[model samples]
Target: MRESAAAWGLQLARALGALWTSPNTLVGLLAGVAGMAAGARPHWNRRDCALVFHRWPWGPGGAITLGMVILHTGDTLDVSCTTYEHRAGRCEHPRVRLGDHERAHVFQYMVLGPLFLPVYLLCGGVSVRNPFERAADRYAMHGRGWWPGRS
Candidate 1:
């Protein structure tokens, strides 16, 4: 019994340590709070991550979803459909595409920690020149032909 208790305690401590050390987890928690405040509800879970959906308060019932800590905001964002669509229709799974992009951003957050925002801004916002955005786009577009139209 004592050995079991010690093992349980060690497990709990390890989990807490991981939580404390993980910048991605910290940023995700903050994103979760923001989503809740915006009347967004948890839509789904993917392994250690979650997806939240909400109606854009200022728009005409536009949908918004957050994956990882990246916000995919637009009038067309929806739970029923993928947030973005390729012009060629080559990518059949929109959510997966968006997830791929946002997960790459999450990796940036993990590496950059609190400096991501400033560094991203310094890198010229979300333009293709921005290394972070470029990396994400590459990850999201891997094996997929370029489709400029996303609605």
Candidate 2:
């Protein structure tokens, strides 16, 4: 098992090296972007749900990438609700319930965005269909968010 793990690591290193040396600049760039987006989707979704609104951020995909990074690094600027408080005998609501799906959305974003976040930022924002969004929608409808009487 240890040998297999080491082999896997070596293979990964070689692949990365080849990518670094590849001549197809556009293809390499696109591949990197895809990888990052795939990795970040979960984290981004979670972060958005935990901190921001139920929808994606404004502007473009870059906004979401930035949001994921900020949230992951422990920075919460405009995040609405990320905590739950239950105070005994308090006049306010007894319990605060955070949206788990929302939190998961942030996680998704973080994983997919950072993979190639710098590229997108440097090249200016691009309008594109985020795979993460599709994933989140499916999850919300079929997974934890699904229930009787709920959309």
Candidate 3:
């Protein structure tokens, strides 16, 4: 009974989180729809719980995650291990795929909701100094959860 209750609670929380983040998700969906009009393709990644739009026409040629949507340029991306290396001292950079990096962003969007864009921009926007990007890179390289609890 306790286990089932916990599962139910978790599901409830997830549904709430989706609702909380829906506004940002709407923007992502609009972008994806525009991309679709311009010949992009959308796919649902069950494992990542994200709608990925491939061949996105905008952005600087990589992947960008907004809430549950991932707009990806048509290319391969290999993220490096900077956070883990900075904290634990390792030099090996893994060849993690772009989807993994974008998945991290989705998780961030889940937590931050509408505040994600402002916070991300304030943190320096697409650089190593930005903790969000670093967290995303760490998740990509280490395959761990996106949220780094503390430094």
Clashes of each: 0, 37, 0
- Which runs of model 3 end up more than 4 angstroms from their true locations? 75-91, 149-151
Structure candidate 3, residue pairs in collision = none
* TM-score, per-candidate, Cα-based: 0.49, 0.26, 0.81
Model 3 lDDT per residue over 30-125, tens place: 999999988778888866678888888887777778889888887333433244344444455655666777878877888788998998999888
How many residue pairs in model 1 have overlapping backbones?
Answer: 0
**Model 3 per-residue lDDT at 108:** 84
Model 3's number of clashes is 0
* lDDT value, residue 112 of candidate 2: 37
Per-residue lDDT of candidate 2, residues 44-82 (tens digit): 233233223222222222123232222221223233221
User: Which lDDT tens digits does candidate 1 get at residues 1-151?
Assistant: 9999999987686455444436655555566566567764444434323343433233334322222433444322223323233333544544435555555555455445556668778987745556665565555656232222221
| TM-score of model 3 (CA atoms) | 0.81
Better of 2 and 3 by TM-score: 3
TM-score winner among the candidates? 3
